[model samples]
Target: MSTDKKRFSADGPAPRQRFWKEAGVQETADGFTITLDGKPVRLPGGNPLCVTARPLAEALAAEWAAAGLDDPKGRFTPADLPLTRIAGTKIERVRPEREHIIATLADYGAHDLLCYRAETEGPLTVRQAEEWQPWLDWLNERHGITLRVTHGMMPIKQPEPALQRLRTLLATRNDADLAALGVAVPALGSLVLGLALADGAITPAQAVAAASVDERVQMERWGEDAAILDRIAAMNEDVTDAARFMELGRG
Candidate 1:
């Protein structure tokens, strides 16, 4: 992975190869493209895979659906393909534009690490801090980096590693702790719960029962606010997702 340039180089005296030389990305008339982020490069004589934004992808799908552009082998073109979907939402297009979604939109860093707090899952799970121990140790060992930034500087609701740590924080807490994480505290329970449910999961109703807020509250807040839930959940992307984002998989 390109992000691993420094990572790999750190293992030995060998200087990290410049990421660009290794990237193998190329430029075309429209703009530069990476194999990972490239758009609509031609694949055969006169045939092209058009690339564009999600909005553009949807428009193409609508256009194709209307026209019924079936291929000679009965395949579909942009005009005929269904838009790729994520998070119960349909995307008109996929491919490189997802880069924008991940940065401006989805979870993890550009490299796709799960990006958790030093103590996400709130110090309870055996694996909370331990889960990220390798990453933290790696970053610390390599770069001396240790800032648990929860969200990106942008207003988009990115989950800082701090938030993952909060799960642990919450796990050990009583009502006072819940209150601390909510409205008056300005930590904003809506955002917190939304992230928790984003995986469309509950670790176990019984496990959360000791926390003592009615399950209805969780349902009410998120169920009533689907959009908020979507935004918040996306930011809390799992740790493994971080690797996928980088195309390096997990350690």
Candidate 2:
């Protein structure tokens, strides 16, 4: 599929005025599709914006319907339709490049954030072990994927078998799931946590808390800055949205 749709493009244009009076979902042979006033919605790639799950389709319809409801001029950006963006990624990117995307995400396992710890003994170090180690252990116990943990910024090699196991596990996921991981893994910097979130092993709030251990400790030592807080808030939203996308896509 062509990946040149402009509605979701970051540099394409300003928010457009809402044109559709209503959005709806329809079940089709292809899957569940979102519709605007009974017409199907198309992706930036011009492919039908469809998903396998009715709930996800309905969610996409809701996003589209509510896109510019609060604006006086009824203007909204692609950001307003987060689920559509993810579903688009699944169709435009993951479906065409599943193995490549799987490999890319699996590589995050090789250097998962949970494997890196604070270099010295202190609150940061204590917090790292307290907040992160259990998840690493979960990777080992739950998935039989044992990763090597280390201190300091110097890179440490993880076991080849472990990395291969991650790849194998990721290979089993559908395109929709891979799309969600594409968002969650990078946002949390840990395939372990991403997998946990996707598998319902942890909540988005817990995932964010686990991922933000170092940042939280740092902010505690050195006063919290508005920018850092904003970044954390955005990460929470992204991770939460990704988790929600996965959950809704499953149904």
Candidate 3:
């Protein structure tokens, strides 16, 4: 995940003056780029913020265009450009450290959330099987890799062959996909759920629910906490944004 906390801050540096009148997309020899009143957009790394996918370019343009639409002062912040941020990370970070990123993300499979089950049998355990097992089964059936499930906090060592298979699969993804996975995997804390989200195998809501089964069960037993609810809401937004980023990049 990105360590640049400021970029994802909810109250990013006070909204700056909006200088551009409109946003547009222009096709270039390399790919497509977003333009602010005809001026090409540049990433923080000082390179043109170009995307090989036109759909992603157009989406970035739309985000720029809508930045201050709802604010009376016509000002905006980094939070207003989620797609652009992810795209920037794709170019500025993931590309250069592709192999390292692949390995880091694949490591999630070793201690994936779905692989850990509730210690005592009850609603949480039942819900775990109901919500999480299908995806584990999907992983085995689709990729021939079965992740061993354990009950409680004790970590179970996943099969080395399975981990290697996952790493190989992750190596096949492009930088853009890896960028999306970076967000979704950390947010969901489960490589299985993140891959499922990226692959269109599950919707963002489904991923969130499956990942939050423990929290949901706790909330049911002890009532909801406002803070936890807010966290879950933020998580859903993150996952949804990542999913959209992946979809646009594929186009």
lDDT of 3 by residue, 136-177 (tens): 999888778899999999989998999999999999888999
**Quick one: best TM-score, which candidate?**
2
By lDDT, the better pick of 1 and 2 is: 2
Candidate 1 to truth, TM: 0.22
TM-score per candidate: 0.22, 0.94, 0.92
Put down candidate 1 lDDT per residue, 55-134, tens digits, no spaces: 33333334333332222222323212222112112112223233332222222222222233223333333333343334
In candidate 2, list every pair of residues with a backbone clash. 5-44
User: What lDDT does the true structure give each of the candidates?
Assistant: 0.29, 0.89, 0.89
Native-vs-model 3 lDDT? 0.89
Write one digit per residue (lDDT tens) for candidate 2, span 10-81.
Answer: 676578789999999889998888899999988888999988889888899999989988777787887788
Clashes of 1: 21
Candidate 3 regions exceeding 4 Å error are 1-14
**Model 1 CA deviation exceeding 4 Å by range:** 1-123, 142-144, 149-251
Ranking by lDDT: 3, 2, 1
Deviation (Å) of 148 in candidate 3: 1.2
Q: List the residue pairs that clash in candidate 3.
A: none
Candidate 2 RMSD computed on C-alpha atoms after optimal superposition onto the true structure: 4.9
